[model samples]
Target chain A: MNRFLWLVRREIWEHKAIWVAPAIVIGCLVLLMLTGNVHLGPFTDMSGEAGLGVVPDDLQVKLLVIVYAGLALVVSMIMGIVGFFYSLDALYADRRDRSVLFWKSLPLSDAETVLSKFAVATVVIPMVALGASMVAQLVVAAGGSARFAIEGLPAAAMWRPEALFGGFTVTFLRCLTAMLWYAPIIGYLMLASAWAPRGPFLWAVLPAVGLWIGERVIVGSTFVGDFISSRLFGLYGVLSSRAEAGFEDGEGLEGLRNVDLVGSLRDFYASPELWFGLLAAGLLLLGAIWVRRYRDETS
Target chain B: MGELIVARGLGKSFGSTRALDDVNFRVESGRIVGLIGPNGAGKTTALKALLGLTRFEGGLSVLGLNPHLQRHRLMQDVCFIADVAVLPRWIRVSQLIDFVAAAHPRFRREICEQFLARSDVRRTSRVRELSKGMVTQLHLALVMAIDAKLLVLDEPTLGLDILMRRQFYETLLNEYFDEQRTILVTTHQVEEVEHILTDLLFIDRGRIVLDAAMDQVQEQYAQVSVRPEHLAAARSHQPIAERQGLGRTHMLFRGADRVALERLGEVGVPSVADLFVAVIQGARA
Candidate 1:
């Protein structure tokens, strides 16, 4: 257990972009908020004697959905962006500099080494994203209350511990769901990173793109293209399909409010595509470990 | 204190080229064995096979474990500093210690810290910021701290200056090696290690040509110089190799009676370098 933790720590040490990149993005968002750049004019515009028209009676419910989901969306998306580059570089950098030799020289097996890296991309980084999102949301909430107090309105309702804590809890669950759902993609990028002689991104992406193009041109079929799109965009499909089924036709926001991840995750695991994608990921992850184990450093 | 390594018919090929071919040897505990070979003689390949870094075709065992099949378990007792500098340059000195302690079950942290304390290497300094010699010192310190039974060094001082190179071997000999441990070292600078080795294995073209105790090398091979007039008599002994310098012909004789060679002219025990050349030439002949 400690061994695996150290390996993950090593990954964090080497890839500063993991925390540094998201931190910078969050810093910029905060900076914008502080500088009065986020007016929320369209969302908050109102005219009333007490100026409380900006926040309606159902404003807390709406804000709960919007803030939590928006923060979760922003953080998870930015994490995915960072994860793409991180997974691409993870296995490649060690071999490029011949640190693989040093790493393999340790008593740990190749499986342990590669799996820790996979865990970093899929599991650890997502939790970090979740934490970043929660922190950012809290800061923004604090700012919102500060602005509300400056105008002599009641701010306690907006900063209620229960609502804010519930928002954070919901976002955590969402991030966990999204990252697990995205594991196959993470595994693929890491496989490419492990095996590519150079330019791992090209190695990973070109084959998929070329195959998609070839399938479209040669077979006149959208199967492969749709499969790729489904993997890329399937989280929303998984979340919304059940949500849409549960609610009335035009009630997406309300359906989204009822995103029951545990029940939905059960459905997610039942999907044939999910099983197949995960199987493929398992095979590729094994290949990555095998490559790390057997490939000679000098070559 | 028994046989620590045994390899037989060990073979490996890289594409059309065989890097190690039908190699066989054994290393006993408490001995320092020098694997001396010219470039492309399968020295690195054989070392890699022994270290479990590569797969082989035939029977090979290190510390009673199949090196390739049970590499992770084998690594607990075996350590190596390859011919190249392999420490990741991005890590800090302290982080490197922390990592080794975490990854290796047998690694002792205080020993590593103790070793580091004797040097000027700062705990916070990145490997990239250190001089190459300092990096090697740091590497030696880490390797020494590990309680491994067999240490394999493939040209461990390949790029260091003379003083540091000498220091590397000194540290290995004085600080690391013990009656319970074994050391297998490979080097192109044979002369530097020649005096320290208890046994020598000279290889060429992917095969080991000479495997003998250093004392046996003294008893089995003799270098002699004969006058032009006595050359015919010296040739009767069938020298393994011959060289002409300063109007005298020097012959390297394998398994010849040293007393007989002394009768021809001046007879002496050949250096490891001379024996390496003669053995390779003799194999060709």
Candidate 2:
């Protein structure tokens, strides 16, 4: 575990681009918000016809809150972008540079190597981006609010700690859980990087696509479509388990309004499936280790 | 510690082609062994197998551990520098050093920093920005920082000029290497490294053709330059390899005395390159 920490730390220290990536994202978001105009539409029904020229107070407040929340998700996803590159390429870069030999020579095992990569790719990178995004979000929100005030229009709910940090923590945990649950995907990527000769990414993704296509061709089914929908809509087995727990506990959104962040974490922890996902993630991580041990580093 | 590395009938195949076949050798601690072979002799493949970077079908052990099974634990005592150009392009020299310090228990950060003063490599520049020679030196600096029982180098001085290559090896000898540490070096330019080598393993087409002490090989092989009149007699002894040089014919033969060769012509010890060529052709035959 100590060696794994050192490996993860070394990866972070070398990748200066990760530190710079979020700043670029936050800066772009701020630039967009400051120059663009915002709309509230109608206060009564958010989906109703637009009541032009007279923005009701309630309608304006909801729109402001909704837009800010949407922006937060955008920022969160953008911040999480490093995961794809970092996790997918983590094993590859070392082998490419032949540094795997150096690292392997240092009493670090293949299992440790793969797990540290998984932790960095899925856990640590997001945490770093989350912290960076929080700071940048504050700056963007403040600047946009002041600019709106200068134009004599009321700024959106830029200072709602409830909507920003509260939502971010829960969503970040959800993203983390989702990434953990899909550990097999990341494991396959590691395997691809270890074995495949020419195209690691393509080799990793193409088989899943081919299986999806083959399944459809054989059964006239839509498993891939359903799978995509489930991932995006949060209707996977983990989510279903959480829903069941939510039913038993009756704690859905109760603490959301008060921004009792710890309460929200408690609710998240209530699901037994999170532990199950973690265990499965561990197994998949072991599989990655097995593959990397026999992997030809030159390949 | 009696055996630093041991391999018995180690073999690796890729699809239909065999990269390594029935390779068997051992090295003791405190020796600088040279692994020399032609381009396709599987020198790199054997090194990878010893390091546990690739899985093979036969017996392999390093420091009493199966490299294939306990690579990480094995790595604790072994340091490797595959190529000088392999340091990450995005990292600075200082960051690489700091990273090694954090990652490896045996890495001597102070020694690395001290060597930095003598190296022409900049501590702050990104690896990709440095010239090829500088990159090799930077890599050497990092690997030298680690205190390990074994160091495996595959083409360690590649892409560096003569001066830089000399500096690199000199630093390795002065700061890092000792009687307790063993280094397995593989390179095409054997003459450059021949002076420091205590042992030699000559590989050809995935097989070890010659594994002997450097002194023993020099003692047993002789180079003879004979006139056309003596060529017939010299040819009778079946030397390892033969070639026609300017105004004379040079041949490499295995024998202590040139008594038999006196009937053929004049005899002397050939250069390492000539010996390498002769040994390779002999192995083929």
Candidate 3:
């Protein structure tokens, strides 16, 4: 376990993007908040509908949740891209620089090395993104509250501890579920990173694209395409579908309040796709370890 | 001394090109064995096989463990510097030390720090920021601190200038080597390592042409600067290799009677470089 920690630390040292990307996103979000350019369209629309033009306490809670989600969304999206490129480069970078020879000289095994990078992608990157987004959320909340105070509106409406706690919990759960859902893709990227002689990103994408096209042209079906889409965007699809279902017949702000983010996540956890993805990720990670162990450093 | 490494019929091939062919050798503890070979002569291939960085066919063991099957375990007591400047360019010197200290149970951090303190490598500088010589110094510091039983080096000083190369071997000999440890090094710069190597294994085209201790090489091989009058007599002894230089015919002989060779002219032990050339050419012939 101690060795494992050092290996992860080594990954962070080599790939600064893991932390830097999320930090940049947080900085941008904070800057946008400070500049007064953050357009809370839903908050403005709902405030206009309230009696006496005061945002209702319940509507304020809903708007605060939206604010948290929006901030978290932007940071997590950037983190997602960072994680993708990180996994592609993790195993490949050392080989490209002929540093695998140096790394392999130590007592650490290939399995430990590969798994450390995997943990950084699946666990460390998400946690960093979550933490960065939380900071961004706090700044946005404070800035929004100050704006409300200056405008002679009720700033206290956004400070309900229970509602704010719930918002944080949903964001945390979303990051966790997204991590688990994307494990297989990260595994595939690592496998490509380990196996590719060069251009690991293309190696990761082109084969799947070729398989999809081949299935369409030769097999006359979209089984591969459907599977790829479901694996790639299935979590977001379920989350958005749940939101739509919750707001189907309800009125606007009330509908937003009714969206069961936690319930949707719970449903996502219970899906067969998540379990199968975890399994595939396990196998792909083992493939990465095997390749790293046996594949000679060609350079 | 215990046998630190033993290999039999060790072989590897890349497609149709065989890098190692039915190779066999053994290294005992407390020895600095130079795995001397020309370029593409499987020097690196043999080191890779021994280091567990490549797979090979045949029985090979280091410290009683099969390198390929138990590389991680073997690495606990076996260290290597694959080549100069192979350290990751992105890591700070301090982080690299922290990592080795954490990852290698046998590594002594203070020893490494002391070594670095005497050198130009700064703790905060990234490897890429350091000169090639400094990078090698840092790598050597890390390796020397590890209390390992066997150290393998493949072209460890391939690109360094003369002063750095001299310092590299001097430091290794003075601080790192002892009877409890063994080192297997491969290099084409035969003259640089000739004096420091206690044993020599001359390999050519995947085969070991000569394997002997330095003392044995000294005792068995002799060079004679044959005068013009004794050329027929030296030729009759069938010198393994001959060249004309300094107004005389210099002939190299293996296992020939030294007393009789003295009759030809001034007799002396051939340098490792001269012996290597003579042996490689003899093998080719």
Candidate 4:
């Protein structure tokens, strides 16, 4: 276990983009908020609905909750992209520089090395994104409270403790589910990194794209295409489906408030696709370990 | 002393070209064995097999453990420097030290730090920022700190200057080597390592042509600088290789009677460089 932590630290030391990318995004967001460039168009429209040029206290709290959630989503997206590039580069970089020889000279096993990369992609990256998002949320809330006070509105509306707590809980759960959902992808990228002699990113993407095209040309079916799309966007599909179901009553924003984020995540966890994805990820990770063990540097 | 490494019928091929073919040799503890060979002679391939960096055929063992099967376990007792300048270019010197200390159970950080303190490598500088010689110094520092039984080096001073190469071997001998440790090194610079090598293993065309102790080589091979009148006599003794330089014909013979060669002309033990050439050429012929 101690060795594993060191391996993870080594990965972080090598791949600074894991945290830097999200931090930069959050920095930009905070800068924009502080500069008064954030135009609350939706908040103004909601206030217009009240016919008093002032948003109701309850509606204002709801809007703040939505703002916090939106920041988390944007930061998580940047982290996801960072994780993608990181996985592609992790195993291949050592071989390109011939540092794999030095790394292999140590007493760490191939399984430990490969799994540490996997853990960074799946777990560490998401946690960093979540942590950055939380900081962004606090910054936005504090800034929004100042704005509300300067505008002579009640600042307490921006500090709905229960709603803010719920927003953080839902974002944390979403980050957890996103990591589980994306495990196979992280594994596949790492497998390519381990196996490809050069241009690992192309190796990881071209094969899947080629397979989708081959299936389209030969079978006149989109099964492969659908499968790829479902894997890539399936988590959002689950979330949106539950969201749309809540909107069946035509509640709009109120409907979003009623959407059970935790329960939808529970449904995602229970799906056969998630379990099968995990299994496939396990096999791909095993392939990575095997490739790393037997693949010679010269080859 | 026990055998530190033993290989029998070891074989490896890249596509159709054989890099190692039916190679057999053993390294005993407390010996510095030089694996001497020309380029494309399978020196690196054999070392890679022993270090578990590549796959091969036939039986092989290092410290009684299968290198390919139990590489990580074997690494605890064995260490290798594949070549100079192979360290990661982006890592800071301090991070590299920390990593080795954490991963290698037998590594002593204080010893490594002490070695580094005497060199010009800065702890905060990335490897890429350092010169090639400094990079090698850092690599040697890390490897020398590990308390391993066998150390394999493949051209460890391949690109360094003369002074650095000399210092490298000097440090290895003075601080790292002991009675309980064994070193297997391969290099093309025969003269630089000749005096330090306790044993020599000459390989050619994917096979070991000669394997003997230094003393055995001294006893079995002799070179005679023959006068023009005695050239026929030296030739009759069946010299393996003959060269004319500085108005004298030097003939190298294997297991030739030293008294007979002394009677022909001035005789002396052949240098390793000369012996390696004679042996490789004889095997080819």
Task: Give each model a TM-score.
Answer: 0.92, 0.83, 0.97, 0.96
Q: List the residue pairs that clash in candidate 2.
A: A43-A59, A105-B75, A107-B75, A107-B76, A108-B72
Instruction: Enumerate residue pairs that collide in model 1.
Output: none
TM-score between candidate 4 chain A and the true chain A: 0.92
| Model 4: colliding residue pairs | none
Model 3 residue B29 CA deviation (Å) reads: 0.7
Among these predictions, the greatest DockQ belongs to: 4
Which segments of candidate 1 are over 4 A away from where they belong?
A41-43, A47-56, A151-154, A237-272, B225-229, B245-248
lDDT of model 3 at position A10: 89
Q: Second chain TM-score per prediction?
A: 0.94, 0.94, 0.98, 0.98
Candidate 1 achieves a global lDDT of 0.82
Q: Model 1 reaches what TM-score against the true structure? A: 0.92
Q: Where does model 1 sit among the CAPRI classes?
A: medium
Per-residue lDDT for A1-299 in model 2, tens only? 66677778777876655677777877776676567643322222322334312554433433344444345456556645566556567777777666666566666666777777787777776676556656655765677557555555445544556545644654555555546554545555666666656567787678768878887899889988566445434423443344344445644333223322234344445666456656765666676677677757763
Clashes of each: 0, 5, 0, 0
lDDT of 3 by residue, B36-74 (tens): 988899988888888888889998998999988899999
Each prediction's Cα lDDT score? Answer: 0.82, 0.71, 0.87, 0.87
Q: Point out the worst 10-residue segment of candidate 1 chain B by lDDT.
A: B77-86
In the range A1-299, model 1's lDDT, one tens digit per residue, is 88899999999999888899778878987887687565433234431345544455454544554565566677788888888899899899988887777787789988988999999998888888888888777767666656666666565645666657766776776777777677788888888898899899899999999999999999999899898888888787675465445545435334544544245656876788777777888988888888878876564
Q: Tell me the spans in candidate 4 whose CA falls farther than 4 Å from its real position.
A: A47-60, A251-257
Model 3: residues >4 Å from true position, as ranges? A46-54
* lDDT tens readout by residue for model 4, B1-285: 599899999999999999999999999999999999999999999999999988999999999999999998999999999987689988999999999999999999999999999999999999999999999999999999999999999999988999999999999999999999999999999988998999999999999999999999999899899999888878999999999968789999988888899998888889999999999999998
Every model's DockQ: 0.68, 0.60, 0.85, 0.88
